[model samples]
Target: MDPIQGKAAGTAPVPLSVLDLVTVGEGRTATQAIRTGVEIAKLAERRGFHRYWVAEHHSMPGVASSSPAVLLAHLAAHTDRIRLGSGGVMLPNHAPLVIAEQFGTLEAMAPGRVDLGLGRAPGTDGATAAALRRSDRLHEGADEFPQQLAELIRFLDDSFPDGHRYARIHAVPGPVQGPAGRPPVWLLGSSGFSARLAGTLGLPFAFAHHFSAQNTIPALDLYRESFRPSAVLDAPYALIGVAALAADDEKEAHRQILSGALSMVRLRTGRPGLVPTPEEAAAHEFTAVERDFVDGWLSNIIAGTADEVRSGLDDLQKRTGADELMITANAHGGEARLRSYELIADAYGLPG
Candidate 1:
């Protein structure tokens, strides 16, 4: 089908990017998922997307990006120009020093192309969160996320407080020495706490509108209101992450996104599994309650033909005043997913 066209007439041209979960589709292996992620990153670069980020999710049958740092290294090696990083690394899951070192290594390898977006959530179920932390205490680590973020920044900047124990220990391959010293840090959030913190720290912020559509604007508002100028940013910089699935038409787009919609339903219903195909989703029997639940979950998604999706995105950008927009499109097959992005890129007039 021919791609639809649209122009953001009144607003400035905003950068487009991608956030991938490395989703494993029905009848697909994790290896295939990772490979497809690499393929998509390459395509995104060719299509002029500004950055490509992988999310961290543990113990999920559907997501292969349990280790975003490792996966980012692979993606960085495979693609030349597109910036690669974690959509975010869940800060509470590991030690601050460890994360600093891992991302520091990534910067050493790819240099100016690495970004570090941090999140406080566990990124998994309660049991898995506990296991990842190697402690039965689940909530404690999350509560310490702010402190962890500070320490991570200090490590990356080689500026730990003199009295701090870690002050003497340098995060090896420490801060890059040129124009882009440390990997740019971004705070990822779905709520107000993270928004305020990111703003207070003067870091770039990314709000997850895909799942937390209700909180998107509020969080961004809080971020901007609380923002303070720092070395990293003189003004508040924000990006909104949205679920955007594009196809030949509205019906085709809706059909293609059924896999993701059904996956969300299964996840919320305590039966989280691999992403089901459109056929599988179509075949599943939904009770009235289930139908309602699925509809509510997918209400945030912007799915349609290229022009329709572009219009939705333009409205979102105008409403939020976001500096950039990151799209996440999940489909049952790699080709369909790629096509969705291609159509959106074409509609947005992203440079090749």
Candidate 2:
């Protein structure tokens, strides 16, 4: 298949909606992290971002966003435009009906702006997963995601389940009148298998490029090459999540990214820290191999000045043919993080 291209212009345009203020913060409150996220979303909208999404993670002290739906609803209530949704909600962790109800209600409250990005992984350790399950529903947690997905879709669609017991059931804000009966849905994955499944099922795809750098390209390729248009999407629509950190200079940007980097390092090494202040990160001794991995990870990351970021984003879009770009900025403090996104918006000609 030929490569997909972005809209070219004589001048640079802020490519896609800017996503901001994600934290994994050093010594910060969950409330503080969430408020910071909301502030970034508001700024992005003012700057002309297209959407704002929150992620879900469980049992991580460094990361506060455990319930994406709850936070998304908070963001939806605050913003008038800019679509609000989950970067992804891990499907394996919750019942399909419950997720449908949560996001379905969100769609009802905010009418035309809700996106449900679903992931199949269990976002936490085995013990947490066990704690989240009900005893009677013990067997229900098995890998029935495909079936669960179908059930969620049916629940969201007022016309689904024709003549069945659930047919009479109504998903309140039932039949949200829009381009489609329900809000748009995208499958989130970091591997080729998911890309193929998403393609076969006829849904848009969003790759977790922020974490799974190795699988990013192959998965996208499979999705695009195998894509067959469905009722909801006429062609393949791809979105990639990239860790974006920007500062006045490359040196400073690199420093800012260390907090998020250390957070990941802790996860990998079983010694997580509060999003480290740059000083703390730079002071820590990293093994030669650890430093090499960090170097590779940083190479995959997009950080530097605005012009640098624009050029990188252009190349990334060209390489992946992604329809949308979700920029996850895990800069240390609230102010700096917001500034990074502001720079991106300014450089790319995104509104703000």
lDDT of 1 by residue, 21-103 (tens): 89999899999999999999999999888788999998888899999999998998898877888889999998888988898
TM-score of predicted model 2?
Answer: 0.90
| TM-scores of the models, in the order given | 0.94, 0.90
For model 2, how does the per-residue alpha-carbon lDDT over 279-345 read when each residue is reduced to its tens digit? 8889989888778768877777899998888788888877877777888887668877888888887
Q: Which ranges in model 1 have alpha carbons more than 4 Å from their true place?
A: 1-12, 176-180
Shift of residue 91 alpha carbon in model 2, Å: 1.2
Name the candidate that leads on lDDT.
Answer: 1
User: CA lDDT of 149 in candidate 2?
Assistant: 81
* Location of the lowest summed lDDT over 10 successive residues in candidate 1: 1-10
For model 1, name the residue pairs that clash: none
lDDT, candidate 2, at 264: 75
In model 2, state the lDDT of residue 168: 72
